[model samples]
Target: MFFAGTVKTMLPKVPSTSGKMDIIRPLAYVREKDIINFMKHNEIQAMSCGCPIEAGKVDSKRKEIKILLQELETKNPNIKQSIFNAMKNINLDYVLGYTSGNKSKG
Candidate 1:
């Protein structure tokens, strides 16, 4: 995928997902500066952190995040906790020496 003056342009071709790859691989190379400039120039709101649990339509994702944050804030009035909850989760699956056992399990 590539960007062209405030527009994310993708080649008119089928995406590839062969071999061991589950997601389709993008071929074009769009510079990060170009994308950032485009977004800034066009006044784009927020960028998606690309979460797996994101569902529904493209516009709905932002709304869902806002709703979740509001609910969390209502439950717990701590600003730090709200910010912590908003941050993207770190995937611990591939982390070395990390286990899911409690103190008793040891």
Candidate 2:
């Protein structure tokens, strides 16, 4: 289901009782239309498990990192390549596993 509203309006007033449901909450605020466009562009039918949430978080982080990299590129054009190379060394599975593990503990 697609939800559109302010954070206060969209979020549940109380905690959710549904355990391990599939829901992707954006790290950065996004308009409903933008989200719809993104889904259309990516050809997504529906979300299952927590993969989409993790993927959304990763995508948002990448975008944020890209902006920072662009700013740093102004100082040293070579920085972008170095950063991208370093990013390749990241164990994404480990990272996601760690995050999910922590969530379960909470």
Candidate 3:
């Protein structure tokens, strides 16, 4: 993965995982000022990597879900405790395949 932008760019922070190696191996961390050098040093070869795009989509969906949750809370303020209880009981590790050192035991 090539992160090419200024530090203030809206790029999301890299996520942590339980795997032995990083899921997204950063090829280079390029700043805006070093863009020219970065382009020169890296060869333009594309295989098939949809991680960045998919990550963005997932991030957007998460934001949308957060908004919906906020709306639900606002509309049903009395059920806040129940919602919290439900969320606490839900375990997503196996569902998202991040259980047991990044392998799902389900």
The parts of candidate 2 lying over 4 Å away from their true place are: 1-59, 84-106
Per-residue accuracy of model 1 over 36-69 as CA lDDT, tens digit each: 8888999996656676456433656456656766
Ranking by TM-score: 3, 2, 1
Tens-place lDDT per residue, model 2, 36-79, is 88889999775655766456655665466557877997999888
Q: Rate the local accuracy (lDDT) of all candidates.
A: 0.50, 0.54, 0.50
Better of 1 and 2 by TM-score: 2
For candidate 3, what is the lDDT? 0.50
Candidate 2 vs 3: which has more TM-score:
3
Off by over 4 Å in 3: 1-59, 78-80, 88-106
Please state the error at residue 99 of candidate 2 in Å: 17
Best candidate per TM-score, number?
Answer: 3
Clashes of 2: 0
> What is the Cα-based lDDT of residue 28 in candidate 1?
36
Candidates 2 and 3 compared by lDDT, better number: 2
